[model samples]
Target chain A: MENQQQDAEPEDNSWLQSRVAELENNWRTAMADLDNLRKRTVRDTVQVRQQERKRAAKELLTVLDNLDLAIGHAEADPKTIVAGVEAVRAQADLAMSNLGFPRYGDDQGEPFDPQLHEAVSVVPAVGVKPGTVVQVVRPGYGDAENQLRPAAVVVAKAD
Target chain B: MENQQQDAEPEDNSWLQSRVAELENNWRTAMADLDNLRKRTVRDTVQVRQQERKRAAKELLTVLDNLDLAIGHAEADPKTIVAGVEAVRAQADLAMSNLGFPRYGDDQGEPFDPQLHEAVSVVPAVGVKPGTVVQVVRPGYGDAENQLRPAAVVVAKAD
Candidate 1:
C-alpha cells in the first residue's frame, strides 16, 4: 500500500497553472489506461481459466475413458482384475494431481486434524488415543493455502 | 481517443493557477494505478499457466500409478492381465478427453484433410482419390487447433 502511494508522484505540479490542460490530459489518459487494463484483466482471467479447464478436462477425460474400457474387460477375467482396476485408479489420481491437487490426508498413523480431515465416524480405539484418526474413509487433497478437498475419516472416540 | 480530447472542454482550467500544484499529484496517482494494473496482468498470465500445468500433471500421474499397480498384479491371471492393461489405457484416454483432447483422425472413410489428417502413406486405390485417408495407424488426440499431438496416419495414393 505504501509503495503504491509513493509512485503516484506527478513530476511537475508547481507550474500546474500553466499546463493545467496538459496535467489533466495526462492524468485522464493514465486513468483510462488503468480502467482498460482492469477490464482486460478480468477478461484474461476468465479466458485463462477456461483454457485450463478445457485442457484439464481433456486429459482427465482420457483417463476416465480408459478406466471405463478396463472395467468392461475386468468382468471377463477375475484373476488380475483388481490390479487392472488399480492401474486405472492410479491414472485418475495422476490426472487430478497434475491439476495441482496433490493428494494428502492418507497418513494412516497421523493424528486427526479438523483442517485436513472430515470425520465420517467416531470409533472406540483400543490402543489409539482419543481425537486420533482411527480410519480414513476417503483421502483429502492439497495443503492449507490451496485446499482441493478434505479427507473423510473416522476419529477415535473420547473416554 | 477522440472522445477523450473533447472531455476537457467540460471543465474550465482557468482557475487552476493556485491549484496547479495538484495537477502533478493527480497525474501521479493515475500513472501509479496504470503501472499496478500492468504488473498484475503479467502476474496473472503466469499464474494461469502454472495452474494449468499442475492440473495436467496430476491427472496423468493417477493413470501411471494405476498402470504400475495393474502390471504388478498381471502375473496373478493371464486372462485378466489384458483387461487390467486395457482399463489403464481407457483411463488415460478419458483423462485427456476431459482436458479438451479426444481421440481423433481415425476415420478411414473421411477424405484426407491436410488440416486434420496427415498423410504418412499413399497407396494406389481404384476408387479412392490420392489424398483420401486409407488408414490411421495411430489415433491422434485433439485437433490441430490446441491439439496434443497430430495423428500418425496413412493416406491413399493418387494413380
Candidate 2:
C-alpha cells in the first residue's frame, strides 16, 4: 500500500501541472483578445462618424447645386428665380428627411409637449385651448426619440 | 523515507491544483470582458453615426432658414432678391466647410490632376498648357485625403 500511494502521487502532480499550463495559456490569449477588441472599437467609432458625415454632406450637395442654378438664373426672371428657390427649399427638406431627421412642428392647434416643443412665448388667444401650440416660430427636425432640436413654438395662455 | 515522501507529494498536489483553479478563474473573467466589449462596440458605432448625422443636419438647417427668408422677400426688388440668394449661397458654402468638406476646383488655370479633377471633356484652348483645367463644370468637396467627389472639369487638350 505504501508503494502504491507514492506511485499515484507523481501521476496526480503531473496532471495538475499540465492543467495549470493549459489554463494559463488560455488566460493570456483571452487578455490579448480583449486588448485587440478595445483598439478596434476606437477605430470603428471614428469610421462610423466619418461615413455618416459624408452621407449627409452628399445629400446636401444636391441642394447646393439647385441653389446655384437659382442664382445663375436670377438675372433672367424674378418670378422664375422664386420658383427655382421654392423647388430648392423642397429639395432641402427632402435631404433632411433622407438623413433621418424629417422636418416637423408646423402644425397649428396641436397639444403642447415639452419634449418636442419649446415654448418661445405664451400668448393669450381666443378659441385656442391653453397649453396648445398656437404657432410654430421655427420648425424642428427628427422625432421625439431622436430629436435634433425641439420646435420653437408660441403657446396659448390660460384665460 | 516512504512516510516523508507521501507527505511532500500531497503538499505539491494541493499547490498545483490551486494554481490551476486561479488561472481558470482569470481566463473566464477575461473572456467575459471581451464579450462585453464586443457588444458595446456595436452599440457605440450606431450612436456615433446618429450623432454625426445630427451634427451635419443641424448645420444645414441654417441654409434652409435663409432660403425661406429669401423666398419670403422674393417679391421685393429683383436685384435685392438676387443679393439675398447670393447670401444664402455663401451660407450653404460655409455650412459645407464647417462639416469638413469645403468646395474646391474652381481654379481656371490650375494643372489638372486625376485625383482632384474628373475630365468631363478635353477642349482645344489657345495659350493654355495641355492637361490644365480650362473650366470647372462642377466643384468638388473635400480634399484628396478625404474626397467626397472629384471636380468635373473641361481640360485643355494636348496638341
Candidate 3:
C-alpha cells in the first residue's frame, strides 16, 4: 500500500501543477481582456463624440444651404423674399423632424398639460374653453421622454 | 508508512479541490464581467446618440429662433426684411462657429491650396500671381482635421 501510494504521488503532483498552469493562463487572458476593454472604451468615447458632431453638422449644412439660397433670391427679387422664406421655414420644420424633434405647433384647441406646454399668459377668449391651449407662442420640439423645450402658450381664461 | 501516506492524501485532495473551486469562481466572474461590458456598450451607443442629437438640436434651435423673429418682422415691415435677413446671416455664421465650424471666406487674396480651397474656375487678371485665390465663391467651415467643407473659390490663371 505504501509503495503504491508513493508511486501515485508524482503523477498527482504533476497533474495539479498542470491544472494550476491552465488556470493561470485563463486568469491572464481575462486580465488582458479587461485591459483591452478599458482602452477601447476611451477610444470609443472620442470616436463617438466626433462622429455624432459630424452627423449633426451635416444636417445643419442643409439648413445653411437653404438660407444661402433664400438670401440669393432676396438680392435678385425683393418680391420673392417672403415666398422663399416660407419655403425655408417648412424646410426647417422638416429638418428638425428628421433630427428627432418634430414641431408641436398644431396642438391648438387641445387640453393644456403642464408637462408639454408652458402657459405664458392666460387669456380670456370668446367661446373658448378654459384650460385649453388657445395659441402656441413658440412651438416645442421632441417629446416628453426627450424634450428640448416645452411649447410657450396662451391658455383660455377660466370664467 | 502506508497509514501516513493515506492520511496525507485526503488533506492534499481537499486542498486541490478547494483550489479548483477558487479558480472556477474566478473564471466565472471574468466571464460575467465580459458579458456585463458587452451589455453596457450596447446601452452606451443609444445614450450617446440621443445625447449628441439633443446637443445639436439645441444649437440649431437658436438659428431657428432667429429665423422666426426675422420672418415675423418681414410681414410688418417689408423694407426691413433685407436688413433683418443680413443679421440672420451673421447669426447663422456665429451659430456655425459656435458648433466648431468657423466660416472661412476670409481666405481670399491668399495663395490657393488644393487642401483648403477648391478652385471652381481660373481666370487671368493683371498683377495677380498664379495660384492665387481671386474670389471665394462660398465659404467653408471648420479646419482640415474637423472640416465641414472645403472653401469653394476661383483662382488666378496659372501662367
**lDDT tens digits, residues B1-159, model 3?**
223324355456456556766887887788789779878987897788788878888888888888888889988998877788778778777777876788887877899977788888989955888888989999988887788889999998888
Q: Could you give the C-alpha RMSD of every candidate to the true structure, in order shown? A: 8.5, 4.2, 4.8
Badly placed stretches (over 4 Å) of model 2 are A1-8, B1-8, B75-78
Model 2 clash pairs are: none
Clashes of each: 66, 0, 0
Evaluate all candidate structures by whole-model CA lDDT and list the values in order: 0.67, 0.85, 0.80
Error (Å) of candidate 1 at residue A140 is 2.6
Better of 1 and 2 by DockQ: 2
DockQ for model 1? 0.28
Query: In terms of TM-score, how similar is model 1 to the real structure?
Result: 0.65
Name the lDDT value of residue B90 in candidate 2.
87
Looking at chain B only, the TM-scores across the models are 0.78, 0.88, 0.83
Residue-level lDDT of model 1, residues B75-157, one tens digit each, is 56555566567766767777677667777865786777766776777777757766677788767777767665566678777
Clashing pairs in 3: none
Name the regions of candidate 3 deviating beyond 4 angstroms.
A1-10, A124-129, A157-159, B1-17
List the candidates' TM-scores in order: 0.65, 0.91, 0.87
Ranking by DockQ: 2, 3, 1
Superposing every Cα of model 3 onto the true structure, what RMSD results?
4.8
Model 3 per-residue lDDT tens digits across residues A55-123: 777777788888888889879998888788778778877777877988887789998988789999998
